[model samples]
Target: MYRTSAMKQYQTVNIQAQTSGASPHRLIQMLMEGGLSRLAQARGAMERGQIALKGELIGKAIGIVGGLRDGLDLEKGGELATNLDGLYEYMVNRLMQANLKNDAAALDEVSDLLRTVKSGWDGISQ
Candidate 1:
C-alpha cells in the first residue's frame, strides 16, 4: 500500500503543477497527454482481459478528446481549429472502436496522432 499511496501523492502534486497558472496551450497539452496515457492503459487492460478497466480508460480518453474538440476557438483559430476539431472527432471514433473491439492497433493509431499533435503544441512556447 505504500507504493499506491506514494503514487497517489505524486499524481496529486503533478496535477497541481499542471493546473496552477497553466496557459490554454499548456492545458491542451495536458489533455493530450492524459488521453495518450489512458489509451496506453486501455491497451494494457485489453491484453489482460480486464474488460471493465479497458472500457473505463477508453471512456476517459473519449472525454478528453471531446474536451479538446470543444475547447477550440473556431473564430480566432480559423482553419487550424477546424482541422483539429475534425481530428479530435476521428480520435474519439477510433477510441470507441478500440473499446468495442479491443483493437490495440486502433489505440496505437490514436496515441500516435495525439503525440504528433502534442509535439506541435509543445513547440509553441508562449
Candidate 2:
C-alpha cells in the first residue's frame, strides 16, 4: 500500500510538472486525455461493483469535461467553439447519468465523444 501511494504521488507530481510548462493547447489535450482515462477507470469500478469508486471517478471525469467547456473562448472561437461547448456539456450530463446508474454504456458513449474531440484537438497543428 505504501508503495502504491508513493507511485501515485510520484505520478501526480510528474503530471503537475508537465502541466506547469505546457501551453494552453496542450493543457486542453491533457484534460481530454484525463477525462477519457477517468471514464475508463469508472467503467472498471462499475464492473468490480465498487460503487463509490465508480461515482468518484465519474465525478472527476465530469469535472474535466466541465473544464473543457469552461475553457472554450466562444466569443472568438465562433461556431466551432459553440458546437464543442455543447458537446462537452452533453458529455458531462452523460457522465452524471453513468454515475447515477452505474451505466457502462454511458461511460462508453462519453469515452467515444471525448476521443472524437481529442482526435480533432490532436490534429490541429499546435
**Candidate that would win on TM-score:** 2
* Local lDDT at 47 for model 2: 98
Each candidate structure's TM-score, on Cα atoms with residue i matched to residue i, is 0.84, 0.85
lDDT of 1 at 5: 35
Q: Residues 13-101, candidate 1, lDDT per residue (tens digit)?
A: 34765769776666677777887898899999999999999998888787777767767899999999999989988988888888888
Q: Scored by CA lDDT, what does every candidate get?
A: 0.80, 0.79
Candidate 2: which pairs clash?
A: none
Model 2 alpha-carbon drift over 4 Å, by segment: 1-20
- Each model's backbone clash number: 0, 0
- Ten-residue region with minimum lDDT total, candidate 2: 1-10
What RMSD does model 1 have?
Answer: 7.1
